[model samples]
Target: MLLLQANNVERRFGADILFHNVNMQIDEHSRTALVGRNGAGKTTLLKMIAGITEPDEGTISKAHDLSIGYLAQDQGLDSQNNIWDELDSVFAPLHEMEKSIHQLEEKLSSIDSTTDEYQYIIQQYDHLQTTFKEQGGFEYASKMRGVLTGFGFGEDMYDLPINSLSGGQKTKLALAKILLQEPQLLILDEPTNHLDMNVLNWLEDYLRGYNGSVLVVSHDRYFLDHVVSQVYDLDNQTLTHYTGNYSAFTKEKADWLRAEMKHYDQQQKKIAKLEDFVNKNLVRASTTKRAQARRKQLEKMDRMERPTTDDSSIHFSFHSDKDSGNEVLDVENLKVGYNENVLAGPLSFKERKGQRIGIIGPNGIGKSTLLKTILKKQPAISGSIKLGANLEIGYYDQEQQQLHPDKTVLDEVWDDHPEVPETEIRSLLGSFLFVGDDVFKTVKELSGGQKARLELTKLSFQPINFLILDEPTNHLDIDSREVLETAINEFTGTVLFVSHDRYFLNQVATDILNMSSTGITHYQGNYDDFVNETSTLSQNEDKTTIPSTTQTSSKKSAGQQSYQASKQNQRARRKIQREVDKFEQEMDSLQAKHDQIEQQMSAPEVATDIAKLSDLQKQLDECQQQLDQAEENWTDAAERLEEFDQE
Candidate 1:
């Protein structure tokens, strides 16, 4: 059933049309994502759909008795009640029914046997009981607890007043309440703003299993890829629907653009030929009738407008005047925190030249503190940090504190490099999307994204060989994040950055350093590889405990024996390497089969054949399972080889 529909929707600001002729539909159990770059009026369109505001021209129709829950970006709860009470209020009607049922029970006790009043009360009681059971009265508290726990709140936090929560925590609570309410439609804007990886994973699972329809606007590509089945590309003042997840939409959108451009170019060539004939031959007496006929054809033709995509994105890359030494940075037993308190570590890691190392951990686990400690912005609680020769460090602070709010955008860059000519500086600012009058705007007036771009602009001017960033993709939209990822990947420097963006990590990270309160585990691949290795380790935990570095060192000291022992260890290492290679080949085969099945499923003829599609889907699932097992085996064997090498 269709839950809601928008037809010919238009929103305007003064004489400017933000978006027009927008049409969308939400069906029962639909999962939809609305995606666009920053300043594309996505929030405004969402408000109109949620009935928080009216569109200037259009009609929005909804199913009768439809309930909508809208959670704006960074929107928090404002209530005096405690966390539990605020959620419990969702069952107010059930509570009232319970009260009336109890009252009916007491009245029944006082009434005479077989009285009409007693009989009516008994019927009302039974009806209320049935309604209460159907409405989930008995499970409400457990459901509330489950949601709160999923949002990282514990039983101890239930009594905490809502106003006392942090902004991020309050936003989480607001979302938790909405989920518990279980509305017919859920509209979320940037709901993943403050979520960590674990919470993000939990939320993705919840939304996938959500009973109601969902319309979400989020910049988290990884989350969207997992949660949304359909994508609405809102760009260039129009909305276009694509029938797949975000990754598929990217491919389809590219193919669509190429096709459109090809057709447009072909039409333009034909029109040029027709125009040339009309212009040259219309004046000639011999070919006048033919030229007139061609003119008529041209007049009847429906000209295609020039196909355009949004190209107004920041363009800049990092450059180093000289290369750094082989070892860029080395830390031994580093402890990072404030006021001599250690939040994370006893950590040790080495960053080699040209390696992009992404640090990931839960919220408040000292990832940012580690960066600051390395840069000497704050003192480390213990341990030493060593910087190699010829290393010039550039830091990107997520807080944007490096920017002088009092200075204009032009001055912000110019003040750093006064020797550069004014025009050249303005050109640089323009490249960062700060044009003519925009350059004159004070840094304080710039939005979060603008500040990030400004910081990058400054970083680009520096001839640095080492870049340390903290949450670099914090305020960047999906497009901007991709651009930044490209810049980082193309940089000829070593990067030690902290980020929660798994997609960005997968794109740019050569290695991942998983931080924890106990210690750090270094994985020699991107985010997905880290997940696979960690999962393998977890699965093998019951078989044998993985030794820490110190334990390995102790074992090395104790196990030094004869030459035969060393030779046997070498043989074992070779065996593990063979196992790793075998798993790698198996994984490659399975992955290829998975891709082939997906391609078959996407074929038009197969898509229309239900049985064929279902069979192909099952085959794909089986291939994926095999691929997953192969990856785990590969990780396990590779880890064993790494341990042997370490010894």
Candidate 2:
């Protein structure tokens, strides 16, 4: 069923048109993404679709009684209630229904059975019970708890007042509350902004299993790729729908641009040929008729407009003036934190020349603090940080503190190098999309993205052999982030940066440093590689414990002892192999059953019937649990067999 549709939607600001003729649709359970560069009116469009604002022209039509939950960028919940109470407020109607049911039950027990009032009261009680169950009245508390846990809020934090929480925590709570509400459609803008990787993974899983349609606008490509099935590209003052994820949309957009350019070129050539023929032969009596016919054809032909590509991205690259030694950085037992407190470490890691190391961990694990400690901006709690000889460092701070708020964009770069000419400084700023009057804008007046570009401009002006960036992609859009990735990849210098953008890490990092409260584990690959390796290790750790066998030295020959041990090992291996095979069969059967239940739940007849859908959903959930257990058993048996083989 179509949940919403925007027909010929046009948004304008006074005389300026932000976007026009935008058309899109959202069906039930649709997973859609809205993507564009910053200042492309994505948020404005979302507001119009969410009924928070009216479009200047055209119409947004939503289904009758359709409910939408909109979470704006950085929007947080403001309440005097505690965290638990705030989320609990979403189930007010269900609570009222429960009260009504209890009152009806009491009246039914006291009244006579043969009377009309008793029958009416019993019917009312039965209706309320059914509605309550169907609306998840019995599961509301558990559901709320599950969502809170997924968002990284534990039971201990439930009693905390909303006013006592941080801004990011409040935003997360807002999302958690909206999810519990379970509106027919969910509209999110920059929902992943304050989320760490763990919370991000949890949210992705939740959104995938969400029972309603989703429309999200986010800069996290990895999240978009996993959560959204369709992408609407809002670019060049128009919205174009692509029937795939972000990765697929990129490929399809490139192909579309090439095709558009080809068609435009072909049409232009035809028009030029007709104009030349008319110019040459329109005056001649014999070919005048043919020239007139060609002119008419040209007039009647449909013209193709030139395809426009938005290339106004920050264009700059990092270049090292000199090479650094083999060992760019060495940290031994480095405890990074403030004052006498320690957030992470005893952490020890080394950075070789030309290696791009990505640091990732949960929130407050001291990723940025580690970078500052290495740069000597903050004193470490203990341990040592050694930099190789002749290494010039360039650092990008996530907070943009390196930029002077009172200074203009041009002066920010120009003041760094007074020897460089003003024209040269202006040209450099232009490359970062700071052109003409934009250079005169104060740093404080600049947006986060603009400030980020200014900082990069400064970094590019320096001759640094080692670059340490702390959340460099924090405020950057998709295009700017891609540019930064390319610059890092092409740089001859070493890079050690912290980021939550998994896509950026996958593109640029040659190694990943997984930090934790205890220590940091270094993995020799990108983010995806680190995840794959860590997941394998985690599975191994979760395997069932195997009993150890003791081998006794016998009073026999060495050859006889070796033959006997080999036979014993072979028998053990066969036993483990049989166990592995049995577990595999069980897993296969459970997976088949799981898929079958899912198919039944998706059938139209069952989907519209709430009771049937609920039953199938329970069956599917139970089957999934069994499948998970069977897979764990298989992993354990397989590990045992592999250990035997190794022995």
lDDT score for residue 105 of model 2 = 82
Instruction: Give me the runs in candidate 1 sitting further than 4 Å from their true place.
Output: 109-116, 540-647
Q: Which lDDT value does model 2 have at 184? A: 96
For model 1, the local distance difference test gives 0.89
lDDT of 2 by residue, 67-168 (tens): 999999999989999999999999999999999998998898899999999988888888899999999999999999999999999999999999999999
Angstrom error at residue 312, model 1:
1.9
Locate the minimum summed-lDDT window of 10 residues in model 1: 555-564
Tens digit of per-residue lDDT, candidate 1, span 214-274: 9999999878877898999888998999997787788688778888999999999999999
**lDDT (C-alpha, whole model) for all candidates:** 0.89, 0.90
For model 2, the superposed segments whose C-alpha errors exceed 4 Å read 108-120, 282-287, 543-647
